[model samples]
Target: MSVRELIVLGSASAVPTKTRNHNGYLLRWDGHGLLFDPGEGTQRQMTHAGVTASDLTWLCVTHFHGDHCLGVPGIVQRIARDGVAHRVDAAYPESGTVYWRRLRHAAAFHDTEVIREQPVSGEATRLDTGDAPFTLTARRLDHYVEAYGYRLEEPDGVTMLPAELAARGVRGPLVRRLQEDGAVTAPDGRTVTLEECSVRRPGQKVAFVMDTGLCPAVYELADGADLLIIESTFLDEDEPLALERKHLTAGQAAAAAAAGGVRHLVLTHLSERYGDADEERFLRQAAARFSGEITLVHDLDRVPVPRRRAVVRPRPAE
Candidate 1:
């Protein structure tokens, strides 16, 4: 069985507390893994989360903030140490090319894994390529520095129906024939169509928005997302501070999730001042606005994307 989940490595803001580290997240999607905002202690956090450098396929940085990207060097070095042969794509804001270069080569190691440095210079950049289920798109967000939010959307596909087979006397060879030919002629000369035996099922989508104040792009990228991982650095009471610092409060993040039709909202990037008491407040505020699943993420916690109901049709009658 395939698995898809977001592992929260660290969730603290600029300051780290006894409970929280910094900003680090590992999005595990089936065979691929996307590591985002690897903060200072991310290398150790990954161990606690049971993740290894070999599992990383992509390194995504919203900006060059030290708390958001300081662990890049350790991750790169570990990839070399483990001798991962597959290519790893690193995506970040183009304006921070100098910072990225410094962190990427912070320490020398055998360059076994080919690091594909993809800079997001403009809005709506497609960063990945392959026969993957979804396409990754990045959009600029409102931040003090250059920052971007990312969305992953899967392709739609047709779901086959077993009940429709028996109804049309389509069984055995006729099943394969109908699938290939779209229409199969029965023994009695009756024609069965593929359209009658299948239904189009839309694939799920996931988005990540961090280190940005509430903006239009945030809603755009999060629209209809099955899972939305957003930074909620402050509680509702601290909205003023959030706005001033170009960050998002819990209420704002939840409101954006509600506006975007997000099914599951995972809030991270918490301030250390509130501690355990803060999670309830954040959850209450979010639940008040968004009527979906909400998770106040903790360091090394794994949150899975809520799966949509699989399309099913009645099997064909005899």
Candidate 2:
């Protein structure tokens, strides 16, 4: 079975608390594993979460904040130490090239050439990931510093209906041929079209929005996403502070998710000021706006992407 989930390594915002570390998230989508953020203690946190350097296929940094990129050096060195041969694409804001370079080579043990620097520039850019299963796009966000949000979208395809195929007398190799060729000669000497036997299946989508305030890009990234992992750094009471710091309050994040039609909202990057007791407040604030499934994550929590929406098509007139 194909696995799709998000593993939370750390969920703290600017400061690390006794329970929460800094920001780190690993999104597992089929064959690809995207490591997002990777703050101070991410290396050790990965061990606790049972994630190795070899599991990472992409390193996505939303911005150059220390709490978001400080662990890049350790992760990079670990990749070299573990001798991970596969190419690891690192995507970050192009304006933060200096910060990225310094963190990438902070204390190199044996520099590995496997890491590919794919910087994000312009307002919105589609990343070239070379035959990746999904299309990855980055868009600029509203933040104090230069920041970007990422969205992964799979191409829309069709789901073969066994009943429809059986009715058309299309079986075995004919099914494959019909799917590939869009039409095939059925065993009954009739032409069966692919559209007649399949229903349109909208592809799954996952969005990552971190360290950004309310912005149009945030809505674009989260639009129609099956899973939306976004930062909810403050509660509604601290809206002023959140606005001043260019961070989203729980209500704002949930409003974005509601407007974007996100199915699963995994909120993280919480401020250290709020302890374990304040978690419910975050959930309440978000619940007031978004009716979808919401999760205020903790360190080492795993959130699965919601199952795909079903597409129903009526049978053609006989």
Candidate 3:
């Protein structure tokens, strides 16, 4: 079975509280793992969260914020220390090349694994890993610095119906032919079209938006995403402070999710002032604005992606 889930390694803002650490999230998508914004103490947080360096295929850094990207050196060091042979792709702002260089060589040990360094130069940058299930796109967000939001979109898939095939007497090579050609004539003189048997379902999509004020691309990247991991740093009462800092409050986050047509919203990067119960309240405020599933993420909390809704049977014309 393919597993898709988000592992919240840490979910604090600038400060680490007794329960929450800084910003760190791991997105496990089937065979690959994507780690985003590994803030301070991420190396230990990963250990506590039961996430291994070997599981990471991509490392996405939204910006050069210390609380967001401070763990880069540690991650690289750990990967090299573990002797994992797989090449890890690291994406961040191209302007941070100097910072990246400093971090990459920060107290380096014997380098073992290959780390591919790809940087985002401008707004609306797209990077193709060539073999992953989805394409990674980065769009600029409204922040004090050059911050970007990342989105991953998996390709659409076809679900084969056994009953439809059986009724057409289509089996073995004929079925494969129909799948590849979209239509095939059966052994019997009957013709089968792919559309007749299969339903058109959209592909699964996930977006990660952090440390940004409300922006149009935030909605663009998050639009109709199956899973959206967004930063909700403050409650609605602190909207002014959030706006001054170019951050999103819980209500704003929810509104963005609602506007973007997100199915599941995982809220993170919370202020330490909020208690556990307060987090729930803040999330509920967002939930009030958006009618989808909401998760108020905590350190080490795990959230599974909601399964896609089954195809709705079209009503026959009266």
Candidate 4:
């Protein structure tokens, strides 16, 4: 079975605490594992999470913050040392070209794995991830530094209904033919249309929004996201500080999730000031605004993408 989950490597913002590291996340999606915002100790965190450089297919950085991309050198070298067979894609804001280069080549290795450079520039647009099964889009976020948020969208497909098979007397290769051709001539010499049996299965979407204050881009990235992982660097009590630092508070993150119709909200990149004792307070603040599932991520915590929307079961054909 395929597994899709977001592993929280580190969850601290600005400062690392005894309980939390700087910032890091690994989003595991069917055959593709995305490493996002890999902080200073991300490599070790990955070791703890039972993941390795071999599991990384994409390295995504929201910006050039030390806590967000400092682990690039280690990750790159680790993959090189392990001789990762497939190509890995490193996607980040184009404005950080200088910083990216510095980290990419921070140390030299045999460099067996081919890491593709996919820099995000200009207005928000869908990035080219090279034959990826899903679409990867990015939007510029409002932050003190040049930053961007990313969204993943799977393609819509048709779900075949089992009851419809009996009704239409279509089975085996005929069913596949109906799906492929949208219409098929059955063994009984009857023409069947794909729509008569299947219903549209809307694709699933997941978004990542980090290190940005409340902005249109935040909502855009979160819109209809089945799972949205965003930075809630402060609590409502520190709204002014959050605004000054270009970070969102828990309440703001929840409000954006509600406004964007997000189904699952994960608030991370917490401030060191809020310890275990304050975790409930952050969740409560967000719960007051968003009715969906909320998770205040902890280091090494793995949160799966909620199951895809149920497939519609159309009535059997007469």
How many backbone clashes does every candidate have? Answer: 11, 0, 0, 0
Clashing pairs in 2: none
TM-score of each: 0.93, 0.98, 0.95, 0.96
Instruction: Note each model's CA RMSD in angstroms.
Output: 2.7, 1.1, 1.5, 1.8
lDDT by residue (50-132, candidate 3, tens digit) is 88999999999998989998998899998998987888999998988888888888894887547898899777988968788
Model 4 misplaced regions, further than 4 Å:
311-318
- Cα-lDDT of candidate 3: 0.88
- Highest TM-score against the true fold, candidate: 2
Query: Which is the better candidate, 2 or 3, if ranked by lDDT?
Result: 2
Return whichever of 2 and 4 wins on lDDT: 2
Comparing 3 and 4 on lDDT, the stronger one: 4
Per-residue lDDT of candidate 1, residues 1-318 (tens digit): 778998999989889899999899898888889999999999999999889998998899999888999999999999888988888888999999999989988876776547888899787799764776678889999999999998988787767788777877889988888878889987778888998988877788999999998888999999999999999899889889999999998889999999999999999888777879768889999888999999998888889878765666556799
Query: What is the lDDT of every predicted structure here?
Result: 0.88, 0.93, 0.88, 0.90
